[model samples]
Structures are given as C-alpha cells and as structure tokens.
Target: MADDHGTSIERARQGRMTSEQIRRRMFDAALATTGTRGMTLGFPGLQMDDVIAAAGVSKSSVYRLWKSRDAFIGELLNEAAATFADQLSDDRALRTAIEIVASRPDLHATADGRRRLILELIRVVLEQNYYSTIDSAAWQSFLATSAALLADDGSESLRRVAETLRRGSDRFVEAMASFHEAMGRLLGFKLRDDFAGGFTLYAVLGSAIVEGLAVRHLSNPAVTDNFYLGPPTLTDEPTEWAPSAIGFLAIYDAFLVVDPDFDPRTIDAYLKELATATGADSVPPADA
Candidate 1:
C-alpha cells in the first residue's frame, strides 16, 4: 500500500498550495496571453477555457483565484492601474529634472532657446503619456475592457469601469501638472495663469490629439501621408516623425500663448534635438 500512501500525500500537498502562489501563476498566464488575437482583438471575449489553456493551469485553480472572466479582467485592471501609477511616478521625476536643466541659463542662454526647451519638454510629456497608454499592453487591454463596460450601459459594472478609467485619466493629468509646475518654478511663471488660455484644456487636448495621430498612423500609414504637413513618407519612429510632430505641437501651442509677444516658432531649434534623438539630420547642421 506504499504507492497508495504516496498518492494520498501528493494530493494533500497539492491541496496545501497557497492561494497567493496560485494567483501569481494565473496572473502571469493572463499577461502572457494579452497580445494574442483573443485578448487584443476584442475585450471581455476571452473564454475560461482559453485562459486555462494559455495559463497551463487547471479550471479549478483559475476559479479559486478569479471566479469568472469579469473577475479576472477586474484584477487585470487593478494591475494595470498599479503599473501606470509606478510609471507616472518615474516619469514625473525625470521630466522635472529635464525641465530644470532646460531652464538653466547656461544651457538655454537665449530667450528662443528657453522657449524651445519648454516646447521639447511638452513633447516629452506627451510621449510619456503615449508610452503609458499605447505602448503598454495592460493599459490598452484595460481601456478595451472599460469600453466594453461602457457599451453595456444597463449593467451595474459600468459605474466601476467608468470610475476606474476616470481616476486613471485624472492621475495622468496630475502627473502632467507636476512637470508643468517644475517648469514654472524655473521660468517664474505658472502655465495656466501666465499663458492666458486654459493650460489644462490645451495640455489635455493636445496630448489626446497626438495619441490619436500615433494610433492612426500605426493602423494606417497612408493617413500620415495625406493629412500631415511634411513629407508623406513619415514613419512612426520618433526620428522620422520629428518635423511633422514638432510643427503640429507648435501650432497647438500658438493658441495657448496669450502674450502677443510670444512666438511658438521659437521652438524650431529644439525640433532639431528630436531629429538628433532619432538619428536624423538635425536642422542647421550639427556643426553650425
């Protein structure tokens, strides 16, 4: 009966596995399957069997950790929120430091140079938002999940999903504000108060517009060629995209600048830096 006793021991050991460990395994599986056709193509469409197969875990294990598909998605949204929070924290510090450097007299000796530096900082902030949203699979999935919830307006889940998305967007704005505040400290001016227009509105809308362009460009390269100002050959890589993006950002900023004396074109010099970052030909030639 030794073999039977060993089988009983094995069963008992399996039963004794910790819930946290099981959850971790299931969470990893869900993340692994995120970019696959089933996950990204549609939201809340993935079946229990799909997760079970992808996770390599038994149905009972998944049930124990997440009772249903909705429960699993809820957990995923929480994880995405936590991840974005960490990313925002890191970006806030880095952007602040960059703004401080940009504001330094020695680095930006001319008024034009300073203005350009500030504009570049704005692009960086937008890119940070882009990374947090489009570049992140978890965030994208969470967005899709939230959209699905909103579509089902009659459901009780809509409120929770809406709140989650609203909170996430609010945090994103607050993070952007921190960068603006840091820049303001250096320039001795507040963005919203000093700019004459609603800094908050422009900042939020500009970021959203840029993000939409990025997404559309990815989905259809032809859209960039037909609509954007520069060469129709614009690629999504930051290097190939510098000129058009910088020009667009300048146009957007023009409305935000209340001072008749303020000229958004001062940022032309900084656009070259974007080119340099993308390993493209810098404007005015690097040596000159």
Candidate 2:
C-alpha cells in the first residue's frame, strides 16, 4: 500500500509538469500560428487542427487544457496583453521624453532616446505582424460573439464568453491607440486631425505596410510576379528592409513637409539611426 501511494504521487507530479509545459508550448504555438498563417490568411481561416499539428500536441490534450480553439486563442491574447505591459512601460518613458523635446525642442539631448524608441517600434512593426492582425481578428470575434448573444438560440455560456472577449478587445484597442498616439506625437502632430474625418492616418498607414509585406512574403511567387511583371522578392530579414522603412519614413516626411517649423532633419536623423542599428543600409559586396 505504501509503495502504491508513493508511485501515485510520482505520477501525479510528472503529470503536473507535463501539463505546465503543454500550456507554455501551446501559447507559443498559438503565437506562431497567428504570426505567419494569420498574417496571410487572417484569423477566420485559422483552424484548430492545424494549431494542434503546429503545437505538436494531441487534440485531447489541447481540449483538456483550453476546452476549445476560441478559449485557447483567448488565453493566447491574455499572454500577449501581459507581454504588452512591458512595452507600455517603455512607451511611457518615450512619451515623457518626447513631450519634453516638444516643449524644449533640443535635438541633441533627446535625439538618441527618440531614435532608439523609433527603432524599437519599427522592429515591432516589421517582425510582429501578429500584433496588428490579431487585434483585428479579436475585434471582429468580439462583435460576432456579442451579436450571437441576441439570437433566440443563444446560450448563457456564450454570452459570458462574449463579455470576456469584449473586455479583451477593449484592452487591445486601448494599447494600440496608446502606441499610435505616441507615434503621432513623435511626428509632432495628431494622426487624426480634423481634416482627416477623425480616421487615424497611422492606422491606415500601418495596415498598408502590413498588407504590403504580407503580399510580398505570403503570396505565391506568381502572384507577386504578376504585380511586378517579373520575379518579385521581399526580404524578411530585419537588417535588409531599409527600403521598406524608407517608404514608411516618406509618410512622415510628407507630414513634416507641410509643417514649415518642424525640421525634417530630425526625422532624417532618426531614420539614419534606425538604419545604422538595423544594418538595413548595408550594401552587398561585389564579386562575392
């Protein structure tokens, strides 16, 4: 009896450890799934079976852990929110520094920090397509889940889920809005000025950047070739994407062009800083 009890405890401990690892891998796999596949196809096309395969976990284990695909994704978003907390703190520091620059307009004292912050954000923009795409899916899912509650066949359980999703969507949007506002401030103006009908220029521009990259990356070679009328290639390497970054900088340049007082050199300096840090401006050697 004593031996059996000891054996049971050991098994239980191993089971617990396995469960913990499964949960962690599932979270990571969810991120991977959403990052590559979701960027191209969007979340609506995301299937649970593919997620299980990508995660390398059994469907039984996944269901035991998250109960359903939506529940798994919800937890993934929660994990992302927790991660964003750290980024939020960084944004706060950058915002405070930028506001100081705005008041005093000192390029030398604050330029390094500003450039570093822009590099951080630009890295996120380039590498983490999931950040923007997931928010869009979450918002859509929130509304759909909420609307389902009004149906005659609605269940109380689903309503609860919808409420949770609603809260998640709200937090996600708030975080994104804060980031957008910070970027706008860095540009020395609001992205959604009265002339723009209250629609955020940053959001539109960000979406365009994401879509363009996704097309170049996730689409068939023929599709890209059709657009370019030849073979088209786009690099995923962070260090080799200066041209794309330059394209983004041009939008900021246009904004600065309109403002006679705001110096374009400030932005040019920041882009140079980013290019140096990313090695995006490096030229390949000839006769390699």
Candidate 3:
C-alpha cells in the first residue's frame, strides 16, 4: 500500500508540471548544448538524449515536445527571438544583452565559437540550402517577428521594422569584421593568432565597447577629449534614453575624432568600467 502511494505521488507531481515550464527546460537544454560554436555546424551535433538529460525530461517528453531535431532547433531559435523581442522596448534589456556577451573573461579564446554560432544561425536562416529538413519560412518568419518587437505596432509595421533590424544587425556585423581586420593590423598581429583569444571575443567586445562608449560620449560631450558630443553631456543624457542607429553611428564617427590615436580598445576598457557600474560585469575580453 505504501509503495503504491509513493508511485501515485510521483505521478501526481509529474502531472502538476506545466507544459510551458517543461518546454522552457527543453529549449534551454538545446541552447546550451548547441551553444555558440555548435550553432554554426551544418548539422550541429545535437542528440535527443543529451537535450533530454539537460532538460531533466524523459525521452518520451522530448519526443512529445519536438518530434524531430530540426523541428526542435527551429522552434528553439524562433522562441528565443520571440523572447528577445519582448525586451526590445526596455532600453536596459538591449544594453544588458550586449554587456552579457562582453563580460566573459575568456573573450580571446572563444571568439570564433561565438561567431560560428551566429554565422551558422544566420547561414541556415539566410540560405535555405543549408538545412534540408527545416522549413525555410521558419527562419524568415522569426526574423520578421523579432524585428517587429522594437516597434509599438505588430507586423502591420513589420516591413519597416524588418528593414531596420536587418540593416542594423548587418551594419553591426560588418563593423565587427572590420574591427577584427583592424585589430589584425593594429596589434601588428592577428587577434586570433597573436592575442590570447579568438574571433567572437573580438567581434562582440570590439563592436559593443565602441558603441557603448559612443553612447556615453554622445550624452556627455565633456567626458571626451577627441569626440564631439551631440547635444547633451553624458551626465545630462538620460540613462533611460534610447539612441537611434544614426545616433550611435554619429558617436562611432566621433570617437575617431576624439582619439587621434583611436583604437577601439580604449573604448572597450571604458565600456567595461561602465558595465561594472551598471551591475553587468561578466564581459570577456575580445582577446581574453
């Protein structure tokens, strides 16, 4: 009778679990396992057992949630973008996301790992040929939906929003590549070859630190020596203010004037300090 009661209790506990929580667990497991590098592989080394173990679910649960790996990855990526959009309006959320990417101490070593993750995700989405099984619309749909997050209205303004995010994410991605090239030139060596780290570290920190500090400079013109402040001083700039893409680009151009001997590294360090102040101090150096 006691044994029967324990079995019944276990069943009741399992029954009490919500589907959303269960799905979240599964999604998180997939993200962790696929990671940044694994994301790039043609077919990332994903395993049902591995995700199941990571998610703390039985094989049957995993199968029930996503019948196949392609379905699971597609769903997972779509869900992440959707969740990320939820934070789009909150100025703090975007800053926090970039900061979290930088604060890794091992930025140097894992740079490519991050890049591959990004490139792979984009590659599959951008090139339908990359994945034979997944629906191509899934990728485009995710992009469109996520882009709409920044706007007040929904897909009614999706075309405009999509264009903006695509342009921004592209410009942002290009700037990073140039940064890597510049570093390879500046350090008189390849950041990946000479520095202690890899590409993603360089990519994230190099681009972000500059952008972050540029925002600072735009706000507090006095905080700088080389760059021109836009209107308000950093002190006057609202911590809550959201800078537009052009606003950020102007600051980027300003940094060039501010430091005649400008290296993005200078901004990188300053942003690190600022991030610490903001209580988001997990940035890994681009060459870490």
lDDT of 1 by residue, 1-288 (tens): 999998788657656768776666666666566653323423345566876666555668668777778877766655544443334333543433343343343434345445544555555454455444555554555445544554665644456556666777777666655545445444333344445545455556555665565566567756533422232211223333332345446644555332334433433344344344445443442122
The true-structure Cα RMSD of candidate 1 reads: 8.4
Model 2 lDDT per residue over 94-137, tens place: 33333333333233234344443444444335334423333353
Which one wins on lDDT? Answer: 1
lDDT of residue 99 for candidate 2: 33
Regarding lDDT, does 1 or 3 come out ahead? 1
Candidate 3 lDDT for residue 240: 26
- Candidate 3: worst 10 consecutive residues by lDDT? 125-134
Strongest candidate by TM-score: 1
Better of 2 and 3 by lDDT: 2
- Model 1 scores a C-alpha lDDT of 0.51
The clash numbers for all candidates, in the given order, read 0, 0, 24
Query: Roughly what TM-score does model 3 have, to 2 decimal places?
Result: 0.32
TM-score of 2: 0.35
Segments of candidate 2 deviating more than 4 angstroms? 7-153, 195-288
